[model samples]
Target: MAAAQGIYTWDSRSSSYSEIYARVRSWWELLPDGSNPLFVLVREFEATGVTAGSFAVLAEQFSRRSGTAQAVRCDLELAKVQEYPAPWDGLHVCTVTVQVVDESNNSRNAYAAPVTVMINCPPAVTAPTGRCAMVGFYATAERIVY
Candidate 1:
């Protein structure tokens, strides 16, 4: 979907057959009303040319094929913009979550390896160039400690 939406995808692997598959199934429940928008539809894909292609390319193709694919339904709120305080005022907070039940695909109670997640959001982000660049002056004290 990132590729489809012209977003950045961090897919780096040898080219073989497409083995990367991703999906975002979400729902929203207003704190009070308990009503929110739905995904309308969601789907996961296993691309053939995925091995060599960047996630951007694969995601684009996946988005194109989103209509004719099977999707999974979810019961959690996603990307719900809630108001924050002061410095974070105008900027809304977008949150994504997942539930790992003892199901077939995601059933692992052990803690050896959790799960690597990929979130579906817009491409534009506040990415930092240097180490810990996204961190603000709050870390100045720690920096001085060094």
Candidate 2:
């Protein structure tokens, strides 16, 4: 079926209208192809000491934690960090793009789905630590693939 469609009118009293409407919606909601294999990783850290200069360090730490042997890792790398207007109170939100070898890192394993991993880094109290503490993180490859 074609992916795009014209607007349709609906009649609440007719059952056929509901069926046709649902069919049309399904076409618009088709999943994406596997050409683009990147997904977004959102990490929330304490805002007390996080700064623009610390993004690189935080990204590296995240990459290391995510590519462990237990977790499926297929040349996963940090693509980039998203830009936002400002940080929330007591919380800093960082969105980054992570790239894997395949949709579910299947190139390196037989798993059919992406593994979810949550990793926390030590807090950066002084200037020497050079790392930001990660309070929470969330990422799922299936959603991005869809």
Candidate 3:
């Protein structure tokens, strides 16, 4: 028989919505072209607390602490994307993009993704007030130019 196909609707009274979603995922996995993209629907309120940019920053920090020495070095350069030619004759060369978000959550976009955030920590009793921000970064290893 040719591949059979049918559509069925279930009443919520009979099965929980979670079960329906699980079934859909199982069917998706059986598709012939697994490469097809899967789009999921989630309520805005249902999303996790952090935004995508914040999540990228968190992952970058984790990688910095755990990744290879080159990874750490790359971040250092990324911190200053405008700078050129690998400080101290480094082995890898890279380009960086930075973004800035203001106190009111307004964002300043640059030609590339941001690598650092400027945040102000509490000052000493005699010191002045401060502000805070976040930036994103990514770098690819490049061959030595010289």
Candidate 4:
């Protein structure tokens, strides 16, 4: 599902596919109130600076898919944002944790390797010219420091 959503092009050797698959199944099981796993996958991709064929790949993750895709929802509260000094004097670091969780009350299912996004700011003032780059991304549990 992650590859289908353009969250990433599949890598046969990578463990991300398994992790994402599990997360998707968990979200699907939660059904009614759980956050949309696909939407979150796209957000995770964006956070990681994904490169694909076109915007359509990314756009399809949110809309333009099957009817059931419409039911997918994102939880804004799951993201926690923080600001800190970047390595340079003028640039600042903006970090966001896109936490993935299961609907179950059990804490064990609470966090599934959060998608960490780090952006280097400030964006340019002009349209068509402005861009903020993501300096860091930790896509899965192995990247997380215990």
Candidate 5:
């Protein structure tokens, strides 16, 4: 199913759309693979009033908080499509549905921000796993080699 599969527009009001977790600079990875953890970032919006939910069950282990606005942390499990342990050789990627709530009434204009995560790939899973991105949307997924 496409990322934003179940989201619906009531045909009556504001706006909504979908987003990819990796697109968020704070959550992106240079490489795509199963060895590293992936974070799914979703943003929901409605008039200063409307709110709805019944999100796909695929998002396991999530934390929800609401105040001036609402935000959620999606749990994503990376698949091992690329090779591991080889610097510049293995690339890991994960995809998720963002379900952006649109009270502004624009849907087709929806777009994705694919986060390019740069990793220090090793030749193997190594005793020490690469540092995973922390929670929250990042300004940029810049690579910092130590």
Candidate 6:
């Protein structure tokens, strides 16, 4: 069996953080047997006016045409937090990783249709109302096919 992979990038402006979606390629196949997995990695995350501990990353596999979520939702974990200078002063930069559950038992036709990885930012109780920015944001979806 060989593995098929798709790499998708976030194409919107950094200021738009409400609902960030990465479009997966239509040519990639989604295999059965629970082998298809999507990985989201954010190399640089910044929430202006929000503290490091005041925000969470929520990600889900969704189908826009159907207007339904296809896979289990996950909370991305921040690997590290660091302080920056000048323009980013008082803001914390973080690294995040999200792995969506395997896409299994779904119809091949359903999988063939357009799918997206949607990312959202929800503020914690102590967090102030602010905008979220993601840099180097991308997703990788892989499946093994015979």
Q: Pick by lDDT: which candidate is best?
A: 4
Compose the digit string of candidate 6's lDDT tens values, residues 1-146: 00001221221223123333223223222323322333223221221111123222211222111222323222222222212221223222222222222221332222221122222223522223464222122222221100
What TM-scores do the predictions have?
0.16, 0.21, 0.20, 0.26, 0.21, 0.20
Q: Where in model 2 is the C-alpha error above 4 Å?
A: 1-90, 102-131, 141-146
RMSD over all Cα atoms, model 5: 14.2
Q: Rank order by lDDT, top first?
A: 4, 5, 2, 3, 6, 1
lDDT per residue as tens, model 5, 59-122: 2223221122122222123322233332433232332323334322222333332222232333
Model 1 local distance difference test score: 0.21
Q: lDDT tens digits, residues 1-146, model 2? A: 01110111122223243353344333321113422122221111111112235434433333111111222321123222122321222223333333222111122312122332222223422212443333323333332211
Candidate 4 lands at a TM-score of 0.26
Using alpha carbons, what is the TM-score of model 3? 0.20
Q: How many residue pairs of model 2 clash at the backbone?
A: 0
Superposed by TM-score, candidate 6 places the C-alpha of residue 133 at a distance from the truth, in angstroms, of 2.4
Per candidate, the number of residue pairs that clash is 3, 0, 7, 0, 24, 0
In candidate 3, what are the lDDT values of residues 68-121, reduced to their tens digit? 111122324454433553222212323222221212123322222211111112
Reference-based TM-score, model 6: 0.20
- What tens-digit string does per-residue lDDT give for candidate 4 at 1-146? 13213222222223243554453333222212332335554444444333344333433433111111111222232232222223343232222233332221222223322333333334422112354443333455444211
Candidate 2 pairs with clashing backbones:
none
Error of 5 at 126 (Å): 12
Task: Select the stronger candidate by TM-score from 2 and 4.
Answer: 4
lDDT of 1 at 16: 21
Model 3 segments beyond 4 Å from truth?
1-7, 30-34, 40-146
Residue 146 miss distance in model 4 (angstroms): 11
Comparing 4 with 6 on lDDT, the higher-scoring candidate is 4
